[model samples]
Target: MAKLLFQRVADEARPPAILGRPGCGPPDYFTEVLLDDLVKSGAWLDLELKRPFLALWVNDEDFDFPDWNDPLIAIDQANVRKFAAMDPVVDLESLRGMRVYHDEPYFR
Candidate 1:
């Protein structure tokens, strides 16, 4: 399902704002679920190392994602600038506007 969605974005060039936090499907299973699809579909996926956030884009214009306003979420200086250059209007002052899930550690 996620692969098909991303493939559609790649095919049509309409990138949506993809956001998530700790436990939800996105930031949680990003590496596990989305990376392969993004790569296979030939779309761009910018993974944030510090914080669990990522952006998807096929073209420079349709790029979209949230900015935590906190440096912890930014990958690096150059990467930050690259995202800024892609779409200069995606300014997210806080993650309050996005759908986030609190993750609880599972102990066995």
Candidate 2:
């Protein structure tokens, strides 16, 4: 079940799809600033992911900020095999299992 779900997210988050490109290619920029906005705007739902679990250090007062280190950004095998394959520059394997903390912070 998890494999199928991961594959679905991998398919949806391809750079072209996320960047609204008409053809295959990486985007000119993959910036953390943009990523932060995407997180706060809940744009990742375009990939069908729920709002991510927040980190303990994330200030509740920092409503405008979303931690890039959040598990929502964690790389999995499905992403490595699908989305990450498009970029040769990234060492996707080394990024696996990088969650610094585990456990959901807030209840929806």
Candidate 3:
């Protein structure tokens, strides 16, 4: 199963009413519950400590922002830096050839 996610700082910019709150809704019932469990078990935080940064690139146009790649890319970089800061195990300098993607335009 997969889900589209954005880090807190990126999602909360100017208060994202679109992303809404996380929970078990009709469209993402399974992923929602799994995420809740992960939160309770501190799995995501642990992953930040042990794994490379997880990034899912989403088109800004689909999210109601026009030509927002620059800002989105900036957010991606910030997420990596912030995560590295929070977890000593994250080696940003050692991560090479890593990239943020430009997902094909998402359609409703």
Best by lDDT: 3
Clashing pairs in 3: none
- Enumerate clash totals for all models, in the order shown: 0, 0, 0
lDDT order of candidates, top first: 3, 1, 2
Mind giving the per-residue lDDT tens digits that candidate 2 earns over 4-103? 3222332454331232223422332222223433333333334122111121112233323545476543422223223323322233334434343332
Shift in Å, residue 20, candidate 2? 17
Evaluated at residue 44, the lDDT of candidate 3 is 32
Better-scoring candidate (TM-score), 1 or 3? 3
Distance (Å) between predicted and true CA of 56, model 1?
Answer: 8.5
RMSD of 3: 10.8
User: Tens-digit lDDT track for model 3 on 4-82?
Assistant: 3333322332322223244435443332233333333333354431232333212222322334467644544454445
Model 2 has an lDDT value of 0.30
What is the TM-score of candidate 2? Answer: 0.21
Q: Which candidate is the best by TM-score?
A: 3
Judged by lDDT relative to the true structure, which candidate is superior, 2 or 3?
A: 3
Candidate with better lDDT, 1 vs 2: 1
The lDDT, on a scale of 0 to 1, for candidate 1 is: 0.33
Q: What is the TM-score of each candidate against the true structure?
A: 0.24, 0.21, 0.32
> How far does residue 5 in candidate 3 sit from its true spot (Å)?
12
